[model samples]
Target: MKGINITSITLYSTVAFSSLFRSCAFQVVPTGCGGSRQPSTPSTSTGIGIGTGIEPAPTNSNTIHNNHVMSDDSFGSRRQLITSLVPSAIVTATGVSILLSPQLSFAEDVQVDPVIVDPVIVAPTGEIKKLFNEGRALEQQGNIQASQRIFAKVTKLAPRFIYGWAYLGNSQVALGSLDPAENSYTKAVNLCVESRKEEEKLGIPRCNDLYLLYLNRGSLRLNNGMAMAMAKEALLDLEAADSLRAKPDAVILQNLARAREVNGLYAASDRDYTVAISMTSNEVSPFWLRAALVKFQLGDTMGSFDLIRRVENRFSEAPEVRAALAAMLYAKGDQDIDTARKKFLEIPDRQRLKYRNDEFLLNTISWPPRMIDNIKALSDAVGDAGRVEI
Candidate 1:
């Protein structure tokens, strides 16, 4: 819509990328001073025409460095400004004053007004690139905790970096730290949006980063049970990226399906998931949940039961699946007290009470202690004669 062609592939790519790096704030620490100076304005890099020799402004020394000069409050390189202002008579005739201030000791409470320095844009060095690659590798290998730490360092080193925030959020999600992951995703989206806005203002090529950022944030919200907001956000992102040429990826489709499901749009959600499952090579739990939910909503109890069983067998370790199973068993038990009693008895002592009391079981081990004792005592008194199956 904004003259940037978007496709389904771009949509998925954007979504995936959104989940990876989401910031442009470069990480910098003062060499000797306690607080590192931050740029008041965001940075833009041409990567081609922009000069690379301009160093960052020296915070402590009150030194100002700019490749482009500033005019009328506009920040730019000196050369660019000089070229533009060279034609003006007043600009050429009038001399500007340059001021310098002495440095103060770190411990002393000096009242030196802080200087506002433009950001210094640096190319990603080999070492930083290596760290990023290593972090990605670790993430792929399922070392989420380690990968998250690496990404954190990347963001710290390159605060204005785009990929740094997204990946950090992904690592946090993998570690099951939803709150931090949300924060990271928020930062990523903010950066992506800002970057896109800057690019748009300059009439440059549109970055699909904003599209992906929204999609990833939506997915995170969906999984965390914030479905309504997630769905809305995902819709907005997908729409923005509608013009890209790339085909919609399986992951993006999956996210859309999930968002729809969370929003209670059953038919549409089911269709999306069905398509996603067909596209994906791996067996994902989401597809199972989608189908199971459809069957459940359609009153296909047996179908839902079978699906739940498979989910239990395959992903037994997943707490969500376990909870779902527990819920199903509890519901079934509620419908038929006799059958429920049998099912409850079938469960292990520790888990038996878990079936009876939905949600978190309170003191499972000591539960039914008195009832169990009474039954045992009565059985002992009656012996073989009182062996009743009730």
Candidate 2:
């Protein structure tokens, strides 16, 4: 690397970096009145060391700015070549410096043609970060549509950015755009895996966002339907989330349990539900309710009712408690549907004013498909007779 022109790249028989990295080749555009300046034969391979303050090759009034650097090649930058060469490395330089990465073994005494490459410098994330922040702020202010537009721009700018794709999926889910949301989440999942793979190569631990990405996608697939294949897929995603977790998380376990149950893995579902029940603190009622349903499916009918009774007695005043437990029991078809109907329908209109819609049962509770169908059936069963009068 000693005394080589700063404008020239050391082309060799051996690659300098890991083969996993894609090359950032610059278009080699020759200059001068002649077609191309013959490059000097590359020196015998040896250790690479960075040097400073060497002047760029002379050109016929060829002024190259920072944005557009040309080295007889359509692109070349002293800084960018260094940046692209070192992955997961921190580089702090005083002035203009050239880099030659270590661990690149060149064939001994093999003379090769030297080529200057215009590195495909990746755009800095500052602008994308700023836009992402703006989008997040809009989301906080409840302007989902505007944030959606901004995140769309973010993804377009940096297509591989994981958080951008994840947040875009979030916005689409909020806007009732299920298909688009699924696609965005799928894209984010793939990018997240790639990011984690790179992180592993750098010897860094896995990121925390990965589990949440799986959780959201799995939940979407679970609540969307109880199709055997989709439930199996949701189970796979939730299990992936579980594996990534450092410890048991109640919400993730709850979703995982549901996915497991839908796939008919009763024992595994029961275990996940039990863990969720133990982990739950603030939302203990929902976890127990799900556990109760799982027990009912596992043939512990009396035990399931006892758990449901415990929730009813504890959270008697909470309408969701009544609605969720009642819908599940009513759907079982063998129980006293009338009593369960009364449990769900008897809430007063004044209280019903706040819990007037399906959002609470569908979203807050996030009942699985079969359970949601049962809830819908319970709603239709009583009709106006069950509808509370103000």
| Backbone Cα, N, C clashes tallied per candidate | 35, 2
Error of 1 at 70 (Å): 22
Q: Which stretches of candidate 2 lie over 4 Å from their true place?
A: 1-124, 199-208, 225-229, 313-390
Candidate 1 lDDT tens digits, 1-390: 111100001111222211111110110111111111111111333221011112333322111111111111213332111112222233233585443343334423434344443332222335665676677566546566687798899888866555566667655654566678778867756654544444233323333334445545555555453434355665555434322315754445555654555456667766765665565434334346445555565556796777767656765554334444444444454455344334334434443333233122212111122223322332233232233332
Candidate 2 lDDT tens digits, 1-390: 121111121221132111101110100111111010111111112111111112332331111111101111123223212222343444457564555465433434344445554321112136765676677567556677888898899889867555566667666755656568778878867755654444222222222345656766776666442235477788788888778766876556766787777676777888987876665443334346666766766767786777778767766765656765667678667766987688877765554332334554343344445556666677777573255535
Q: Which ten residues in a row have the lowest lDDT in candidate 1?
A: 2-11
TM-score of each: 0.47, 0.53
Q: Note the Cα lDDT for every prediction shown.
A: 0.42, 0.51
- Evaluated at residue 114, the lDDT of candidate 2 is 51
Clashing residue pairs found in predicted model 2: 26-118, 75-118
